[model samples]
Target: MQRIFANRARTPEGWLQDVIVSVEDGQIASIQAGQTPQPQDRRVDILLPSLGNLHSHSFQRAMAGMTEVRAAGKDSFWTWRTLMYRFMEHITPEQYEAIAALVFMEMLEAGYASVGEFHYVHHQPGGTRFETMTELSDRVFAAALKTGIGLTHLPVLYTYGGAGEQPLSGGQTRFGNTVDSFAELVTQARAHASRILPGDARVGIAPHSLRATSPRDLAEALMLKDEAPVHIHISEQPKEVADIQTWLGARPVEWLLNNAPVDTSWCLIHATHMTDKETRDMARSGAVAGLCPITEANLGDGPYNGPTFLAEGGAYGVGSDSNVRIALTEELRTLEYSQRLRDLQRNVMIPGEGSVGAAIYLDAARGGAQALGRQAGHISIGNLADLVALDGADTALCAVEGDQLLDALVFAADDNVVTDVWSAGRHMVRNGRHLEREQIVSSYTRAIRSLIDAI
Candidate 1:
């Protein structure tokens, strides 16, 4: 079906007057500008390329607000992690699918057209493997298929509880898998992914983090990169940085840059602490720094050096890492706000020559597509027809034109203005609601109740 999104804004090309986008077989066939809409054409207030969440742990969505209660002492990321571990112990495959379905639904409604799930919840409660190795991953895939969200399934390799080949903590057992085992699991994931969504879904490898995998194991897992994207957690916290130094004699990002072929196929999540050299090197390497600003702030992780990184020509993408809040506007807002707070300046993330909001939004869209290995993030011809339409009539966005619309959408308007979202030309969200929102929310409610009771 061919649809026209008239008077929509296109980045790098100002407001296209009466733009008629033709989508065929889930791909944009052609996009004609300066064309008037016909009677059969569907007109929307505003159209923009949807954003991709480059880093996420779908199951974590269920635990979003559950860890807010303050313990006796100061609550830190480690303390929150303890609660997260306990939460993971009781999740069955059914609960995982339920929680993930709801999470994907929320993501779609939040203007995210695709998600890269950095999945690691692998075995059952204890160290025991399920009958199917890809049980949790299968649930993730099922949820994405049900929600019609583009998925990049990254099966995480979590071998150790901390830096070295440390003994797996009781709560960490389910996530542990040897290098060989992880390779086999990746193969299984690829086969499972091929059965659904074809080229739209990809199976990649995620070496959980520097603390979770050994140097040798990290090296071995990189062998799975045969044309697939590789994502890894790196330097999110000061403690992680200290531990990596103790274990590997180098910081996480520095070590990975020195050791692996860190290229465009790699996305280093949260390189929060880095030397100037590491920042410039990472930017030059063509790898994306997957920034989850809301989650980072919630967890008190240090602010990333956005100004320096961007000045060095680094690429980056945003994600709702913990799904604490799943709005693309919030993510972009928080990302820029964090940079502003850090540098004591305004509009720190945008390049000198472009609009701050447009630059951040477009950089995230492009970097996320590269990170997820998808031909999305743009509304051009031949790209995946994943588009989002904003209610331009909204008071906050009224009179906004060109890059100003993007600015308003990112900083002023909330998710309410995102009236429609289409993934691969399939409308999963309409009138600011996901198609399966009610059903997924009900299932999630039951799952969350059960999990709370179990805990």
Candidate 2:
């Protein structure tokens, strides 16, 4: 089947006029500029490559609004984790699949074509393993398959509760595993997911955080570095920085840059707390900083120094880390907005002479592709046919072209303008709605209700 997209706003070569994109066999066959659409071609108003969510914890989507209430003292990421652990107690494989399907559907509606799921929940509530260790991972793949989204399945290895090889806390039991066990789990996940969607699904490795893995375990996990992309949670909170200093006499990102072989294949999530030296080192290493702006704001995580990082040529991509909210526009907006608040300057993200929104969107899209180890984040030839068509007739987007269209989409518009979405040439969302949203949401609602009742 061949389909063509016409009247795109932005492309690799800036704004194209009367462009036509051809897709065949789930890959972009050709992209021709100044071409009129044939009778058989599908015409769209505004076309752009869909985004890749570089970091996510899909099952955490169910815990979105449940942690909003103020706990005993000052609420923080640590308090949120307690609620998250409580929520994890009731998530069966079926519930996990349902929740993840709903979350992925939301991602499609929000203009993300793929997601890097930083999955770590492995065992039953009491740390008991299922007969098949890959049961949870199978559920994740099932969700992606049903939702028509590309997946970088990163199974996390969480050993200790914190730094210094601490024993696993009660709430952290389900996420704990030895390095050997994690290697076996990844092997199982790769083998099982291969039958589902071979090329569309990637199995990666993630050591939960510096606090959770010892130097030896972290080194062992890096042995799989050549096999797939490696991701990890770095210094997101000030306490985490203090803890790292206590344990290793250096910050998390600083230590990782010095110890680990940080490269393009690595994505350090929440390198939010870093010194000038650490930032410069990360920029030179070509590793991606997986920023989740919305989640960071929700958790009161400090803002990332976007200007300095970009000035030093650091790469970054956005994510829906906790799945608390899954809007590409909101993530981009929050990222810029956070920077604006920090720097007290407008248009701080744009370096050269172009639209700030377009620059940010394109950089994130490209960096996200590198982070996920996929030839995606563009609608060019030979790339996966993951595309998004915005409603060009929207009043806010009226008179928008090139970078202006990107600016409108990221700033003025939300998911409502995203009229169509295709992941790997499959129309997962049309008319601004996910194909299976009703059914998926119904199942998710039931599962979440049951979990809440059980708790």
Error of 1 at 137 (Å): 0.7
What TM-score does structure 1 among the candidates reach?
0.98
Per-residue lDDT over 1-455 for candidate 2, one digit per residue giving the tens place of the 0 to 100 score: 76665686467877777878878778899888888778987778888888899999988988888889999989999999888888888889999999999999999999889889999999998899989999999999989988999899999999999889999987688988998899899888988888887477799899999999999999998887655999999999999999999999999999999999989999999899998888888989999999999999999998997877888888899999998988899999999999999989898887667789888899999899889988888768899988888888998798777688888878898788888888878888888899888899999999999878888
Model 2 Cα shift for residue 46 (angstroms): 0.8
Q: Write the per-residue lDDT of candidate 1 for residues 1-455, one digit (tens) a residue.
A: 86756677584566677788888888889888878788887678788999899999888888888889999888899999999998888999999999899989989998999999999989998979999999999999889988999999999999998877787987899999999999999999898889775468888889999899987898899888879999999999888999888888998899999988899999999999898888989999999999999999999997898877888789999999998888889999999999888888898887686788888888999999999998988778899988898898999899878888889988998999988888888888988999888888899999999988988
lDDT (C-alpha) at residue 165 in model 1: 77
TM-score against truth, every candidate: 0.98, 0.98
For each candidate, the alpha-carbon lDDT, in order, equals: 0.89, 0.89
Score candidate 2 by lDDT. 0.89
Give the clash count for model 1: 0
Clashing pairs in 1: none
